[model samples]
Target: MIPDPDEQVLVDVRAPLREMIFPFLETIVITGVLWIVIGWFDAADAGRYGVGPLRLPPEWRNGFVYLWVMLVLWRFVLPLLRKRRRRMVVTDRRIIFRADGFRARPRTLAMSAVTWAEKERGLLAVYLQDSDLPVYYSGLPKIRKIARMINDPLI
Candidate 1:
């Protein structure tokens, strides 16, 4: 994303792809199970011996197809698109988050409004003096250092 006029960007990053591993694995497991069941049912026609293509009842097949579509779309495709399109930008004057699928406008937090920024687990938590809750910035490497940088302009 282009920085605002008179603004300098310090960090521009998207969430890493590794974050999608679990969902990909889940799709694999679910598909594998469905294939195995269908294959077993297809083997030996009428419980007799013969090699043939796997087939499910029409209703069952349709349902499974819909399930697979939803799984692929929701777990795999959507996240991939989101990861590619979204960005977290820390600028000299403000911190901004943009996700194409999530919002039309980038969420902006002025650095001037931040009272403190701290590292919690692997995320950067920015605390505003007006709000008790901290907004977290995830998927950033060297989160502790980044927190310090955000908290202190001098650094």
Candidate 2:
């Protein structure tokens, strides 16, 4: 039977793929707007410094800027965001995580090994157990079955 020790803890299932959809268009638009504003500021600074003319830097190519932003986003930003997301939580008895995805780890829980479990839902208070842990899916496919087991649980 699915172990329901009156208090079981689970982690967010969607945490592994947080912000999966990269907003290429959005990033471009925002970056473009910011660049324009920066150009204006550069012109003002040049005037203040008595520079010949407010000539933009030769290396400030739009293509280079866009590529730079995309590179940083793909190489640094995305990984950081995913890392900060709640993927797995350590419990007294087991670890909970999504087993799907080409690189995701499988979810595993052991009742005998667990000494405590805690689950907190917004405005719902918290569920804590000292014997078993709940392994429920939140965003994955076929998550309903697991959710049902949690809603009306049994030992």
Candidate 3:
């Protein structure tokens, strides 16, 4: 929906450092596990599969692993870039999830549609809070202020 000419933005919420870092850490862990699995397969007896091990030299294996790790790192990079493009904007009339990218479609929830708003505290809670809709502003600084804006009747 188009904003009214008189509409004003009250808060621009962003993902906190913890929210941003966790995904990178998770990606690293997953990629590490994948690397271990690959190593196991490489070391497995060729007789088990009726096929010989890869004929590439040891240096080639190292180079391939390095390239694989770099590719896996891209998984982490994309999320960070996407998060950078994303923003939660609280305005006088609604809450908006804006992603400044060609493939992203902005989402907005009218304030009146929010049944409740609260500042939930906890490690995972901070990162996982959401309304019924897909739009969320968890792990954002000034969360209390944002909640107040959403819950206030006089806004």
Candidate 4:
């Protein structure tokens, strides 16, 4: 929905970095393993460790490693690219979360629905009256200031 004319945006920024941690870690681990395996094979191509007789063609092996690295790294790269398209906007009336450009409808949580806000496990957990569970957000550069805004009644 289009925002109400009276609603004023308080904060407009990217989504939390919490969502990115796992994808990057997984990509790094897989790519590192691939590099190690390729290095082992390349050692033979370099005529090292008496495995010179087992050396395969260097060109194909290099190409294979490059392709594999790109494939594995894409997992992390795609998310990083898409994350730039998403944003979190905090307004006086509500909080609007735009997940990506392709999503026509954004998710929003009304400020009036919020019962309280607290920090938990490096995240800001906002408790809502309509739900039993709290919605969490992180990655704000000024954590304390945002927490204060969330908890402030006059905000």
Candidate 5:
């Protein structure tokens, strides 16, 4: 978590969210590479091999090409085009989330809206995210204060 300009806390939701990124990229990259390589092999073995019949005709290259294009585009290009605009700010009264990349809304969640929060130090939970949900902090240096604040009686 990083401190905001007015000293309000910023708890990045990215850490847990980050767990999904690499695996997703790896899947896409591996699948894309494998498919493209298979397509290339099939194209090369057009007459002599038995696999050519299993592949789409060369005329369908456009479709496979388009699929790979979209995969690569979504995997790499889209994010660059979509501005990275996610901010999770925790203030005295509320938690504000602003995301402008895929979605175009700046949402704000009031502290009172936080129905529940708990900490889990179990091994599974620790490696999965090092935190629990409905979590309010994300490595935001002052975890104790935030936990105490959220669990505070005043609300």
Candidate 6:
């Protein structure tokens, strides 16, 4: 929905640190493993190309490590950075999420489109909170108030 210029913003929610924690941890672990694998490959000679143990040149191994790191950065770190920029603004008529960066797209949900709203909690709730419609917020202060603002028609 095209928001009215006069529409008043009721809530502005930023993606919280808790929302980034899992992806950050995942990136760290995967990158660490890739580094270890690259190191191992550099240190050991492995059978390859139907021949006995073969050792790749140090440059080739280094190149592979560099490529892997780049891949990880693109696949994980870049998205994490973009996610950090995510913000959800709830206006009188609609909810707008501005996700700016790689593959970025703004998402707008008309308040009229929202059929239901509820506060969620539990182990996985923090991660799940951002994806549901109307408002994208997780581990945020006054989340209950935000939910109420979204759900109450009189608001």
Top-TM-score candidate index? 1
Per-residue alpha-carbon lDDT of candidate 2 for residues 73-146, written as tens digits (9 for 90 to 100): 87556665544443443333454554334466555555354333333341111233542434343434224433
The global C-alpha lDDT for each of the candidates, from Candidate 1 onward, is 0.74, 0.47, 0.62, 0.73, 0.51, 0.65
Stronger candidate by lDDT (3 vs 5):
3
Candidate 1 per-residue lDDT, tens place, 1-155, comes to 67888987677777677878987898898788777655555553455455344444556655766777787888888877877666778888988887546554688888989999888887889999799999886675566666766877566
Q: Model 6 Cα displacement at 40 (Å)?
A: 5.8
Q: lDDT by residue for model 3 over 1-155, one digit each (tens)?
A: 34667988777766655556777777778777768756655664343443355443566557657766776667677667766665677777777776634377768777766666666662112121344433344446666777777667456
Task: Give the candidates in order of lDDT, highest first.
Answer: 1, 4, 6, 3, 5, 2
TM-score of 2: 0.35
lDDT of 6 by residue, 1-155 (tens): 23578998888776666666776777788778878777667556565334346666677777877877787787777766876776767788887766655565668777766755666762112122335533334445466766777777476
Q: What is the TM-score of each candidate against the true structure?
A: 0.67, 0.35, 0.51, 0.58, 0.43, 0.52
In model 4, the number of clashes is: 0
The residue pairs found clashing in candidate 4 are: none
In terms of lDDT, model 5 sits at 0.51
RMSD values, in order shown: 4.2, 9.8, 8.5, 4.5, 8.5, 7.9
Q: Which residue pairs show backbone clashes in model 1?
A: none
Worst 10 residues of 6 by lDDT: 122-131
RMSD of 5: 8.5
